[model samples]
Target: MSKKENAAPTTHTSESLFGKVNYTWMLIGLAVIALGLLLMAGGNSSDPAVFDQKEVYSSTRITIAPLLILAGLAIEVVAIFKKPKA
Candidate 1:
């Protein structure tokens, strides 16, 4: 009985660093970033001499892609800093 009284307290912790919500947000951010990067790709002309200004300067690639990337980054930051509710 004395030995039990003197024993150290038990502390159980999760193996993962972040909770499920954080991981979910991280995954969403990664997907959004991937989509942005994919949108920024393509528009390559086979002939180097000939350039297609319209394809390279499309609204989706120039505007939407960057916005998506920024949104993803914001989400990632939020996910990293967000605390799990008790």
Candidate 2:
């Protein structure tokens, strides 16, 4: 066998590139997104004969939820691109 083939492979340490703050922010953003999605959910009627247009077209689901989702996305983007403190 060749010397290069016989030599052991070098391995780097198992460590995350992002700091704790980045991970925290990411989790927060995820939670916010989850909250937004939850707010937008559950507008269905139990009865087939019943239709609630007001419930389906509520401002919370249409405007507030979408805004919250967008804010969460922005937070995620900022967290991903943010530099760690020295």
Candidate 3:
């Protein structure tokens, strides 16, 4: 046999790091995180002298926003670790 005939053929396959579903989940998580950040922002008073304790310490900003952020982070972790479908 010739040297060329003895050599094995090489095949190339292209693949993505993340699947469609994984990307979708990642997007959802990002949206949730953005929402949390938006909720956490904007406690500024119109007047420099006036400080609104209620607005600054609202339950939504203090409690819900952090929870949403944490939940989004957890979702992101799950998405990253999830197995892609063959």
Candidates in descending lDDT order: 3, 1, 2
- Compare the candidates by lDDT and give the number of the best one: 3
Query: What are the per-model C-alpha RMSD values against the true structure?
Result: 4.2, 2.8, 2.9
- TM-scores for every candidate against the unseen true structure: 0.74, 0.78, 0.81
Better-scoring candidate (TM-score), 1 or 2: 2
Instruction: List candidate 3 segments past 4 Å from native.
Output: 1-11
Alpha carbon lDDT of each predicted model: 0.89, 0.89, 0.92
Q: Flag the better candidate by TM-score, 2 or 3.
A: 3
Winner on lDDT (2 vs 3)? 3
Clashes of each: 0, 0, 0
lDDT of 3 by residue, 29-69 (tens): 99999999999995567887987888889999999999999
**TM-score between candidate 1 and the true structure:** 0.74
Tens-place lDDT digits, model 1, residues 1-86? 79889999999985767889999999999999999999989556778897778888889988999999999999999999999665
lDDT for residue 15 in candidate 3, whole number 0-100: 95
> Candidate 2 lDDT, tens digit per residue, 1-86?
89999999999897677888998999999999999999999556787687788888889999999999999999999999988775
- Model 1, C-alpha of 82: deviation from truth (Å): 0.9
lDDT of 3 at 16: 87
Pairs clashing within candidate 2: none
For model 2, the run of ten residues with the poorest summed lDDT: 42-51
